[model samples]
Target: MLIDSHTNLHGETYAEDLDAVIERAREANVSGMIAICCRLSDFEEVSAIAERYDNIWCTIGAHPHHAKDRPDITPDELVEIARHPKVIGIGETGLDFHYGYSPREEQFRSLRAHVEAARRIDLPLILHTRDADDEMADFLESEMEQGAFRALLHCYTGGSALAKRAAKLGAYFAASGIITFKKAEDVRQVFRNDIPEDRIIIETDCPYLAPVPHRGRRNEPSYLPDVLTGVCETLGWTPDEGEAKTTEAFFRLFSKAERPS
Candidate 1:
């Protein structure tokens, strides 16, 4: 069975037909989904969705885009939200220099808080990075030296240099729909050569980068197989092998997310 390691099920786009979305994902052979909480404000809804579905899990954190609003958000606050068993990870947080939605300083501060919280709780730290590969590499190396923390770089599109460094730190990497793009050779290359086979995982990052064949359409967990197709192609593995390995990697990284019965 396949698992979508990242999904924004709480996004407004899914409000009208969430039940249908879940059913379709099930029909697509998707056994589990981690409904990512991108904004601190959405944790309530994200948590409730995780609670309502036996196969669905959720994470807690503020995206770097909202760093300015909560520049002082602390690990204590993140740990408090993570008290629920459904909360399996510490963030969808990191630097997003591509958008510059928040000052670089605020973004750095926000990421440190998440890093500390994940270290304290021994849960994986969900990360997002864009257009700041060098900075991200530097920060992760420094923070890892301070203390090791499990980390997953979701929708990774950074340079291979960063991928190489992250892999050395034992960070996991998630491949999103972007891998299916015709012009994403660099991203596909990283998957092919840089990341360790066991460290690779899959995600939809829905309401966003829908895989090819479903391009320009609203993304959902059901489209994960399409993304898996890209993974199989890049990794030179058959469908069965791709599913088993990625599903294995997903469970290994997100160990707190109990398998669906």
Candidate 2:
């Protein structure tokens, strides 16, 4: 069994045949998935999908890209909404300096707020970081000093320095379809050497980075095997071994997610 730890299944990209897409995922051996909601407005739709599918779960929080839009969202507000049974994680949140979609200050504020909420609720934080490696590492370090909280650096393609720092801080690193890119050997190396096997997970971040063989095409939960294959190769593990390790890692981090029977 496989679990896609991060995805945006509520996006219009999957509107035409969301049911079919989900069925394909099951057929491909993807046992479960966490549908991420990057905007507060979309949480309803994202949660609805999670409620409709026994194998699906969802998260509540803002992406750093939309940080400026909801600069006033409080940690208390996040904690309140996250009380829902289906809400298993605190964010798809963190800094994304590459796009500069939101001011660095706003992004930092939002990230901290999400971190605080995760700590308060004892749920894992799903972090998204980009070109702001140094800042991100510092922020996480400072936050850890305040109080420990579980977090995953989703789709990590950052520098080794950041990876080292995050690992030291007890953060998990989730590999994405990016690992399967022909030019991603450096990323593969980081996962193989730097990240601990027990602290690693896999994702699709679909409607986005699709692995090779399916590169340039729309990604979905069904394509997770390709990413898993890449991760298994990087870690020198067989498919079954990789699945067991990652599945254990997933349940460990997102403890709120009920294991599929």
Candidate 3:
């Protein structure tokens, strides 16, 4: 079965007919999804969606944009939210210099909180690193010196140095629809050989990075095969083999997600 490891199914874009969207994904062969929480207010909505769909799981933590608002958002609070049976991971958190919606210092503080929470609870972290890869790598290296944590750089768009650094830290890398774009050949080449096969992940980052065939349209979990198609092409493998291998890689990272009964 195929898994869309990252998505924001609770966002307003799906407000009118989330069921239809999910049903479409199922018909497209997507067996599961991890609905992500982007803010304090999104936790309940994310959790509710996870509860409603047996195949969908959820993650807890604030995004970089909301970091300043959640300064008081403690590791204890994150761990508490993660105690929910359906909550399988600890973030969508990390540095985002592109928008700087929250101050950089606060973003660092927030990222540390997520790392601490993941370490404390023995859960995986979902990272979101953008233009601040150098800063992120520096912080992550320092943090790794103190202690280790399980984490994945979700929708990774970082340069080779950052990717190599994360791999050295025993962290996983999640690729999104950007890898399928014409100009992202550089990104594809950077990650193709550097990352270990088992630590690589594929995500739609949906409602956002829709892969080719539907490149300009709104994205959804159903389009994962499109991203996988690109990955297979780059890696010189068949789509079925790539799906099986990446799905295997996904499970290895999120071992907390037992196959649904």
Error of 2 at 96 (Å): 0.9
CA deviation > 4 Å runs, candidate 2:
none
Superposition error at 234 for model 1 (Å) = 0.8
Q: List the residue pairs that clash in candidate 2.
A: none
Better of 2 and 3 by lDDT: 2
Off by over 4 Å in 3: none
> TM-scores of all models?
0.99, 0.98, 0.97
User: Order of all candidates by lDDT, from best down to worst?
Assistant: 1, 2, 3
State the TM-score for model 1. Answer: 0.99
C-alpha root-mean-square deviation, each candidate? 0.7, 0.7, 1.0
- Give one clash count per candidate, in the order shown: 0, 0, 0
lDDT of 3: 0.88
lDDT of each: 0.93, 0.92, 0.88
In candidate 3, position 58 carries an lDDT of 94
